[model samples]
Every structure is written in C-alpha cells, then in structure tokens.
Target: MVEQLSRREGDCFLLTPNRSMSWKGNIRIWLAAFILSMLISTGMLLVGAWPVLPFAGLELTALAAGFYYTSRKCQKREVLTFSQELIRLEKGLTHKEKEWELPRQYTRVWQDVPRHPWTPPKLHLQFRGEEISLAPFLNIDDTEELVAILEKKGLRVEKRRRPEKLWF
Candidate 1:
C-alpha cells in the first residue's frame, strides 16, 4: 500500500506489502493447526501408528517455520523521501536495513510491461546506470496508484494505461 507521510521539507511516501493476515493472526492460525495436529497424532499413537506421530510433529514444525518466515516478509517495507536535492529510499523490517540516497534530478521512475494481465508492471528507479526495484509486492491497483503518485511528484518516466474489456 502507498501512504503519504507529513514532512515539513518535502514529499514522503511509505510503501508496504499488502498483508491478508498479521503476525497475531498468523500465530492464531498456527496455534489452531498445532492443536489439531496434536489431537490427531495422539489418536494415531493409541492405534499403534507411531510413525504418524513423528511425521505430524515434523509437519507442524514445517508449518510453524513457513508461517514465521511469511509473517516476517509481510513486515518488510520501503520509505521514499523526495526532498529538493536528494531522493532517499529506505527499506527494512522494523528497522532500516538498507538505504539509498540519489540526486532528485537523476532518479527516474520507470516500469516494464507486465507479462500477464492480472500482474502489475514492475516499477524501477533508474539512477545513473543502475536499476533499483520499487514496491515489488504491490498488486495491480496499488501499483497503478503508486505510479500516479510518483507522476505527481515528477518522478515518472512513462505511463502505462490498463486496457478496457467490455466482455465479462
């Protein structure tokens, strides 16, 4: 999602991945699954199916790990600050892990055409000779919104319009 930040100097925008479920939500889901797995494992153990017990434990462990990693990824975000002289991009989860400072005039926002209709065009910042990816987690609508917002900030290179289809 794209959010505007109040800054006395210049424009600031916060970019975050769309999260269907939060950390707490993920934890709740994991807990429920763990309970179900334990109940089934315990039942199988009573029937002399001891192998299922270990497999269930391993499955629950893998599920927990997958949920944890995904929740962490969802926490990641990027902050873009466009001041008069410099354009600063900060990326991190909870804290600033990486940052890039480029000249405002040298930074340009561009995108490549999407291969699929449902997918949004991938946005990138052209700085000198390098291409820096921006908001790769955004969906179709949010990606277009970000492009529009960047265009208002005079950072957009070209516009890509969505095709209209009347047939459902």
Candidate 2:
C-alpha cells in the first residue's frame, strides 16, 4: 500500500506490503482449522485409526508457526520523507530499525535490475557513493509505479538498465 502525507515543507511517502489478512483474522481462521482438524482426528482415533491424531497435531503446529512469521513480516514498513533540504529513509520492523538522512540534491533514485530476465527489479537510492535498497517487498509493477510517482514529485529518477542476453 502507498500513502502520501502532505506538509507545508514537503511530502512524506509511506509504503507497506499489502496484507489481505489481519493478525486477528488469521488467528480466527487458525482456530477454526484447529477445531475442525481436532474433530476429524478424534473421530479417526475412535475408529481405531489413532495414528492420524499425532499428524493432525503436527500439522496445526506448523500452520501456527507459518502464520506467526507472516504476521511479523507484515508489520514491517518503509517511510520516505522529502523536504526542501533533506530526504530521509526509514525502514524497520519491531525489533530493529534503520534510518538515513541525505541532502536532497545529492540523492538519486534508480531501479536495479538483475541480469536474468526471470528476476524482478529493485528500487534503490544512491547517495554519496552509498546505495540503499527500498521496498524490497514491493512487486515489480508497484516499484515502477513508485518510481513514476517519485519522478512526478520532482525527485531525480534513473532508468533501469537493459538486460543483456547470452547466446552459447
């Protein structure tokens, strides 16, 4: 998702991965699945097919772990603030945080495309010989859209390089 905050001095762009399911919704779904699995496993156990019980428990455990990790990742965010004199990039999750502030004139946004056609391109900011990747979770289309928006807002945008083909 992309959001713009307008200020008297400049603009702030907030970007986050789109999450179809909230943590609460995920928990509800998990609970429903757990109950259904337990019911089926208990029925099988009563019918003398008891081995299904342990497998059902293991399946639920794995599902819970997967949901936990996904929800954690969904909480991460990237914030870009562009003012007259400075541009700031802030990205992090709950446990760790990173921030960079650079002179607006010295920063340039570019797309970094891998040599392979199958790999997706990435958005990056280059400043004073240091390059920082932005919005790693965004898909290629979304990254392109973001680059367009940044360009429209007066930020310098470098074009993606053409991928090279190899003939053997």
Candidate that scores best on TM-score = 1
After superposing all C-alphas onto the true structure, candidate 2 shows an RMSD in angstroms of 3.4
The runs of at least 3 residues in candidate 2 whose Cα sits more than 4 Å from the true structure, single-residue gaps closed, are 7-9, 114-120, 161-168
lDDT of each: 0.86, 0.85
Could you give candidate 1's per-residue lDDT for residues 11-44 as a string of tens digits?
A: 8999999999878898999999989999999999
TM-score of 1: 0.89
Each prediction's RMSD over C-alphas, in Å, is 5.2, 3.4
Worst 10 residues of 2 by lDDT: 112-121
lDDT tens per residue, model 2, 55-124: 9999999999999999999988888888888988889876339999988887888877667666657888
TM-score of each model, in listed order = 0.89, 0.85
lDDT (0-100) at residue 141 of candidate 2? 65
